[model samples]
Target chain A: MLQFSFWDILSNLLIATQWTIVLSLIAFVCGGVVGLILLFMRVSGVTPLEWFTKGYIEFFQGTPLLMQLFLFFFGIALFGVEVSPWMAATLALTFWTSAFLTEIWRGCVDSIPKGQWEASSSLALTYIEQMRYVILPQASRIAVAPTVGFSVQVVKGTALASIIGFVELTKAGTMLNNATFRPFLVYSLVALIYFCLCYPLSWGAKKLEGRLNVAR
Target chain B: MTYKLQFAELLPYWDVLLQGLIFTIILTLVSTAAGIAVGTAGASLRTFGPKWAGAIVTTYVELIRNTPFIVQLFFIFFGLPAAGVMLSETTAAFLAMTINLGAYSTEIIRAGIQAVPKGHVDAGVSLAMTKWEVLRHIILNQAFRKIYPALSSQIIIVMLGSAVVSQISAQDLTYAANFVASRNFRNFEVYLLAALAYLLLAMLTRSLLRGLGRVIFKAK
Candidate 1:
């Protein structure tokens, strides 16, 4: 077996970090968009939409993300269309993230007082208008901390993409560990890198949560 | 353009699948209990331990929280043996999972413990209850009641996260699926069947936890 140098491992990890970030950004953005739609559908006046959204949330939330990733990777192919690992990972993460994000944002939106909806409606605003002008703005404030917090989950989740052959930090660590035959040191470094990436956001989320609690 | 779906091909493997399911359940149960124990200790350290201890706990929680479980598993299974702490693949997988679940559960349970009202503790003290007594009879009980939902949810997450162990070849449900798929070259069908099995298992576990919670927390 060829021995990998420290510099080689570091450089490879750095390269893999880009994929992690890219995967995270894609998942977050796509999840945000889908989550918004699910949120509205969840609370929308239409009954079928509400039920459908609830089922969607439960189905994704109930199952393991690994299974979801596998389903997307292989499930789609079973129907005769081929998808790359990146595409499969993105789709799975986006769907998984959206389910949880919808729930989080729904809680935020629900925490807004019932009176605001009535007050906006009294001002001759339509339902969409009221949401646009009043409810969403207030809800968005409450949403910020949790949203940022959930992004940390998204970041951590990108690691699962590695299972399906999407090479990210975790996958890179495996490669390095295989070559160096040094599991503990490599994984400790991997954990440290992840801590560096996640701790700041966790701190920020806590700070924001504290401020929000005070404001309330 | 027309490949017929074959359910019959998978029927003979039902016995293997059933065994795989049982193993998955056993793994989940063992890890969940072990995780709760580790988590409770970690949570107590954060809540009631000294400064340095709290800092250590904080560092551990953050480290486990940030990194991926797959990496952690690889380190334990593949990494530790290199350092002379050799363990079987299954043992290593379980140990890694216990630690990972412990860190996350520590945070959840800590939040639950902190959510207990100050008045309750004061009341316990006024009744001449010792610190340990207050913690056990009053504070801890109430905290568990409050955090049961979060704890249950975290347990499910742990169960799901357990799937990562397959990478270390633990012969769990996912590993079985991987093996069956390779043997039959029916990757999609095998995984699809495995996904259904996972979904059923998740639902079953959730209901079981819910029932247990109801039985334990009669007031709830």
Candidate 2:
């Protein structure tokens, strides 16, 4: 068995962190697109669309993300379609992120008073025009903090993808420990790296909330 | 595509599933109670304690909140053992979970505590109440009521996240799902069932917590 120096293990784990970063970016961006669409559908004032989106959110949020990843990875394979771990992880994280993002954005929209909607409608504005001109502009401001906060969650969510053989930070730590026989050192570094990735987002969310609260 | 879906293959392992579900419930309940107590103490200490104490609480909260739960679990279960602190898998799982939940609740409760006006707390102190008594009787009740919904959601979140404990062979719902799936080679069916079980568990836990909140806090 070849010995891996501490530097070797640390550098290797750092390299795998790149995949974690990439997966997080993909999931966040794609989920944002889908979440925005879901948010529009949810608030479209169409009862069917509202209920459908609500159920979609409920189904994803109410279940464990681990199980979701498992289902996507294993379920699709059962249908005789081979899915790469990257694909499965991306699919599962995207759906999971969208469900949460929609809910957060929906809350922001809901915080807008009913009068704004009525006033925009009275001006002979269509639903799209009202939201474009009056509602989402205000909502998006409040949405910023929560969206940043949830991005931290999305980053953490990508760690779960490691279970499905996506060689991200957490998985890299596990592999390093097995190779180096240094569980304490390896996992502590892993946790530290995660902390480094997450603390700025957490601090930024707090600052945004403080600034926005002052602005309001 | 007419792909056969055979949930029927996993039916015979209902007892294992039940055992796993019970462990999940027990884990959630134990950690929820302990975590709330820890969080309430941490919140009060941070809010009312001296500089050093507050710093300690802040450190604890930040450490747990910023890291993923799975890493924390692995650190405790696997890392601690390497450092000469052996723990059974279940004990490590429970400790990791309680610590995780406590940090989150500390933040939630702290926010609620801050929203309470200082004058009321001062008035309680001026009326010959000890600081502990003021916090316990006056601040705790009102703050809990204000943050109750957020707290309820967090509780369910912790429960759903307990599925990750299966990685350490905690014999929770996810572990049972994995066991039967491997045995029967019915991976999809077992996970689908397990996922459904978690959904029901999430809904049930939410309602149960909501009902408890109503009874304890009395309706606003």
Candidate 3:
């Protein structure tokens, strides 16, 4: 068994932390774009589009992220496409994040009272204009907390990418634990790092949730 | 890409899949029950206990919430053995899952408890109810009614998360899928079947929770 120093494990984990952050950003940005489109499609009131978006959300949300990662990693290989672990991880995460973010944003859009839409329609605003000017502006206020809250899930979800050999924080922890033969110590540090990354967002989410509750 | 989607390859593995499904269900139910117990205790401590107790529960919640479940699972499964606390993969997976579900449920249930109006508690107090009685009859019940949907959703998510335990060779659905896929060399078909199985499981769990909510809360 390979032996590793404490500093060596820490440094490796620190380096791997960058990948975790980068992957999260990539997944967040791409998922945000796709999620926005999905939200629009869901609210467009087109039956097929609604069904398609719903199906997309359910497919990702209903299944485990680990299975999705496995499918992307191994399933794509069968089609004669040489996909890297990074590509597969990113694709799975982006799709998964998009499904959730779409549902989240759609709830935000829906939470705007019906009277706002009716009033906007009475003023002869097109659907696009109403969304751009009236609906979204108000909806965004309600959306902020849940969106921020969901980011915590995204960060945690990125840990699943390590299963496909993406070498993020969790994967680094596993490697270090293997070398050091100290599972609890290595994992506690890993958990600590993740807590540092996630707790502020959790606190912020709670704070925003409180503000939202008080506002209503 | 000339890949044909042949699900027929998975036909023989239906029994294995069923076994995996049963295991998955058992794991979910056990963890969920254990989780609720932990969550209730944590939430109560956080809400009404001394300062140190509240702080400790808060710390536990944050630690579990932030870390990846897989890491948590590894720590329990692989790490514990190093400390001479060996457990089978299934037991470790179940323990990690219960702990994870407990933390999230604590937060949700705490919110539910807090959402119970002060007047309800005051009324319970005025009726000569002891603190424990008031907590049981008023606060806890009302919180459950309010948080049932959120709790149920979390339970379904936890069930989905059980797939990760396959990494430790727990023979959950994902493990079975991995086995069938490698044996049949039909990776796409096996996963598609697995995904459908998961989807069906999710639907079934949700409906069951809905029925449960109706029975428990009388709100359906």
The lDDT leader among the candidates is: 2
Please say which candidate is ahead in TM-score: 1 or 3. 3
- Per-candidate clashes, comma-separated: 0, 0, 0
Off by over 4 Å in 3: A1-3, A212-216
DockQ computed for model 2 against the true two-chain complex using alpha carbons = 0.80
Q: Model 1's DockQ?
A: 0.66
The reply for model 2, stretches above 4 Å from the true place, is: none
lDDT per residue for candidate 3 within B1-220, as digits (tens), equals 7877888878998998889888999999999999999999999999989999999999899889888898899888987887889999989988999999999999999999999999999999999999999999999999989998999999999999999999999989888888888798888888888888899999989999998788887743
RMSD of 2: 1.2
- Winner on DockQ (1 vs 3): 3
TM-score of chain A of 2: 0.97
**In model 2 chain B, which range of ten residues has the least summed lDDT?**
B1-10
* Clash list (residue pairs), candidate 3: none
lDDT per residue for candidate 1 within A39-153, as digits (tens), equals 8788677899989998898888877788889889977777788889899999999999999999999998889898998898889998778778898899999999999998999
Task: Write one digit per residue (lDDT tens) for candidate 2, span A1-216.
Answer: 798888998899999999999999999999999999999999998999999999989989999999999999997887788899999999999999999999999999999999999999999999999989999999999999999999999998888888889999999998898888899999999999999999999999999999998998
Question: Arrange candidates by lDDT, highest first: which order?
Answer: 2, 3, 1
Candidate 2 C-alpha lDDT tens digits along B143-167: 9989999999999999999999999
Give lDDT tens digits, candidate 1, residues B51-89.
899999998888888777877888788778778899888
Which structure among the candidates has the greatest DockQ?
A: 2
